[model samples]
Target: MANKYKCINEFVVDSYDENEQVEENDFFIVEVGSIWELQDESYLSDVRLMDNEGRWLEIAQSHLVEDFVKLN
Candidate 1:
């Protein structure tokens, strides 16, 4: 089978008010420098970085808009 995963070019982490909070699977927008470069888009679920193990860490969000991505 062909590749089924691609990394997104953007991963942003936002904060709520002093009395609010963020939730899991929070909907957000992500832009990529090159969709072709990233062969896996699902990997960008939360767009966060992880530790040596399997976890989600915070990644800087991207603001670029130059391409579109499709399922392969």
Candidate 2:
């Protein structure tokens, strides 16, 4: 199993499409849900984060800028 992460800040996801002229990546917010960081053995790269909206983003861990909170 892998560790899960929740987006604390708004970030951009570069989602490619058939259109060659699109210059912007998709924007994601905290409400979108948590992102998951899978282990190295997984077929996907170790740095990829899985978004709650089902979008897989390949981003550096440092760029994520995440924080964890304790729950009661």
Candidate 3:
């Protein structure tokens, strides 16, 4: 069983390279109303989520504050 979430706020994330380094000029925005599924929650600061595209992303827990609502 997986928990789903709906985005309530738009947020931007930097693109990372194969080495996991942030690309200075590359970023993407997660628009409001996007839905994501919880992938992993073992990390203390961030949780992994799978977007509609099936891409897994790890975002800061703080960013989720007031930004998403869980849908069980």
Candidate 4:
């Protein structure tokens, strides 16, 4: 089964700004209390989190231990 987690601290997620048409890093914050699911366990992996509107967002593995707590 996939492990579930809850965001305990706000963290930044790097994303691309399609409108800007640049390769530079664009960031956004994942608020505390957001729930996430472990997606890939490999190094530099990702986690999936659902937004308020029911859309899923992918978060980098770097924030896993730093900002989230395992739920199950």
Best by TM-score: 3
Query: Mind giving the per-residue lDDT tens digits that candidate 2 earns over 1-72?
Result: 457666555555556344422337554443334555543542322365554456555555555545321122
TM-score of each: 0.19, 0.48, 0.73, 0.55
What TM-score quantifies how close candidate 4 is to the native fold? 0.55
Q: Can you write out model 4's per-residue Cα lDDT over 8-71, one digit (the tens) per residue?
A: 9887765434342323665667778887665553322465555554434555667667888888
Candidate 3 worst ten-residue window by lDDT:
40-49
Specify the highest-lDDT model's number. Answer: 3
How large is the C-alpha RMSD of every model relative to the true structure?
10.0, 5.5, 2.5, 4.8
Ranking by lDDT: 3, 4, 2, 1
Indicate the residue-level lDDT of 19 in model 1: 39
Model 2: pairs clashing at backbone N, Cα or C within 3 Å? none
Across 1-72, the per-residue lDDT of candidate 3 in tens digits comes to 678999898988766665656779998888889999987563333777778785555677876666889987
Instruction: Please tell me which model should have the higher lDDT, number 1 or number 3.
Output: 3
Cα-lDDT of candidate 3: 0.75
The local lDDT score (0 to 100) that residue 30 gets in candidate 1 is: 35
Off by over 4 Å in 3: 41-45
List candidate 1 segments past 4 Å from native.
1-8, 12-20, 33-72
Per-candidate total of colliding backbone pairs: 8, 0, 0, 0
